[model samples]
Target: MKIRDKILSGILLVLIGVLLGMILMFFRQGTFSFDLAEVKVTEVNRSESPIWTDDELEKIDDRFVFKTIAKTVTPSVVYIETLINARDRREMSPGEEEDGGNFWDRYLPRTRTVGSGVIITADGYILTNNHVIESAVRDGINVTLDDKRTFDARVVGRDPSTDLAVLKIDAENLQNAVIGNSDRLEVGEWVLAIGNPFRLRSTVTAGIVSALSREVQIIDDLRRIESFIQTDAAINRGNSGGALVNTSGELIGINTAIATQTGSYQGYGFAVPSNLALKIARDIIEFGEVKRGLLGVTIESVTASTARRAGLNEISGVLIIDTVEDGAAAKAGVQSSDIILKVNGVAVSESNQLQEKVAMFRPDDQVTLTIWRDREELETDVVLEEMQPIVQETQTIPENNFDEEQLGPEPEMWEEIPGDENSGIEQQSFRELGFSIRALATPEDPDRFNLYLHRVQRGSEAWNRGLREGGEITEINGNRVHTLDEVEKEITDSLKNHRSLTFKIRTGQGTDGYYQLF
Candidate 1:
């Protein structure tokens, strides 16, 4: 009886061990399936079909335009939240690199910022501002749709010059914005700014287009393109990258910035026009980059002084200051001081406007430029060139390295310019003029030693008139100056006559402008 009892006990113990092993295996397999399962969200659907026919949209009552536009656009504009980890600078200790860091670091504090985005396609391609998700960490972007569904977002591409970025989510059949022609937007037209303002989602504000092609100088990049549509819409924080729709429920712009003094709306808002935004978005989606075409010339707005100097009858068009060697404009016979009256027959009065027009095209695309030179209008066909990336030119003297003699005049002082044998540079400071002058040592040779403005005092009359440092003094009072003495004599003569000094300055950026200083 004792041996039989021992055998039964051993069988029972083995059965209990087998039961425990099965339970453990079941739980492990359940956890793996729950955590590692793939979701069906990877397909991208790109179509050119319109969401709603014009006739179908036109059937709506005129009185319901605002409400219809709001309802249709709200679903396309999404709320974007980004998490930027604050522990980016935290160093991992010994034996911590295997799992990335200490376990506690995973729960470290994060900085969160909110913005908005517009769905440009049905497959979940989104367009927003670069500043919105510029520094977001890996897998840290969460997008909340109008229907309250959330998904992780991935960056498609970014264009800092345009302040634009593209993102993608694992979504399909999403409501997309109906893009309209922004070039046809007129001043005083009714428009709506729709976005999440101050964390308030789906906020809409009504306003009229106050201006067009406004260069507010808000973009921080040197290669920035600013031809914003200015409106009196109430755009505040968190409204960035939102949609600015027209009465026809069409997307006209992307709400970008507000001209405010108290951190709220003060009757001014700006947006990137839809035509440009759409082009940028498509480029990013197709090529993973912004392929901007270049005119290969430095241009400036044609002011009254410049118009008069260029012998123009009216203050209109953009002035070509200088042309790059072998550039599109140069190859097309576009000369310095020529006024660009129109591009493809569209009048461009500001540099930003011209930039926007050219930016709409790709490299090798030909454009017609109506130029005003010698008081006559002439048209030339220019093939747009690829924009060259900004490169730091290697020179014997660094840009900021200064010498004592290169400093400016009596009341105001400027940073210096270092001399080098390779440049054959010489400088002279004119205290009476509030600036210093520099030139090549071979002053007698016009080609070798063109006079350059080494320094100009801050707040000086010349500086205020746009006579900046590193400017080549090509001409003074309509006469070309090859030597420093000639430049001084012309200035003295102008001052003696009590006349405003007219200077033709060619800036380091290769833009030429005429400035009048008294």
Candidate 2:
């Protein structure tokens, strides 16, 4: 009976061992049957790739290629910094400044603005937007590279018409991005945008060219020229003068403007075509300004409504609204109410085309213009003329019997008011003055800032002595004058001594003269 019990125990142990082996095999799963078909999961082990396909191989190749090119071009590009200052107009009451009421009136100071620029040359020429240096505020320009090296820069020249400027830095061993022909660019081409957006230095964005030959009204009718390269790349306020490069890392344009109702990027971007920018930059560097031919005709676009009202056969093309007197168009006999259909065989569909066409010529370059007058197609050859240097006229007011308040709200009083007849000092009369001048404020300028004294009346004692308005009188009747206070003190001393003040003055380029303030 004992032998039989031992044999039974051994059989039970063997059965238990077989059950454990089955459970272990189930957890190790390699093959599974889905309704009778085997799905060899093969236990992937997650980290190791069990299958390789041809499509995946191609994607891997493309990614590596793009990554290589991106890494190569990044080092060659750079970021620029520009500092601009302009008049900040804010009115304030008397005693706001230390020099509360001087020069017969109290004053307010101007303000400063800061911005960015782009480096286009290795030996130090940089291109930027004109609005960056709008005011007489052209100081503290700097250029920085991707490696964090910074250098000082100077304004070489600026063109307000195209909203472009040139800057120079005194540095060597720099990288210049390759410039490509923008004329060869096509819509839907891939491009990259590089700029300092919102002070974030050296950022790059990518997009496709959405359009070409875009016309935009930058300024309100005063001066407008349109030549834009539209792209989907995002651009902002600080992106002016940035590079819009092709896939090959060749610069094709300068990112300048964006179309957005909210004053921010909304998918549309505009760039200055590189061909035009190259010409402008060359001219500015050589001539210290841009010199281009003008057609002298106020051009307009023919809309469907205008075509209906005017009974036009064709609904497209630019119309000559008015030819400037004594201008190229005027000399060529182009008249108002005439329509311009083409130039050099290129169809002009809008007024902006006329500007772009004419700007392509130099002062002496002549071009053929086609027009539609009286329903007849006519052609005329015009000899372009160089635009002369513009002279800005200043204002000068008559020094009539006046008080101090109209001179701009001065609290200090010297004489009693004489009813409404005495309407303070007259403003600067631009036609009579012949110079652009403004007062210097305390904090804005403070040091070596320029100020103009009252002008020398034509028949007054000052003019008879050849003393001019710009003349700087430092001493009166043997009394010294430095600040405006000294000027007042000297005048008081002269009045106290009952003698005319003989003033020693500094003139143009430090030429000195003497005049008696009788």
lDDT measured at residue 357 in model 2 versus the true structure, 0 to 100: 76
lDDT of each: 0.82, 0.64
Whole-model lDDT for model 2 versus the true structure? Answer: 0.64
Query: Which portions of model 1 miss their true places by more than 4 Å?
Result: 1-64, 87-108, 309-311, 392-518
Model 1 lDDT per residue over 54-148, tens place: 55656763434777788889999999998876555455453566345667777888898899999999999999999899868899999999999
**TM-score, candidate number 2:** 0.57
Question: What range of 10 consecutive residues in model 2 has the weakest lDDT sum?
Answer: 391-400
- The C-alpha RMSD in Å for every predicted model, in order, reads 20.6, 18.0
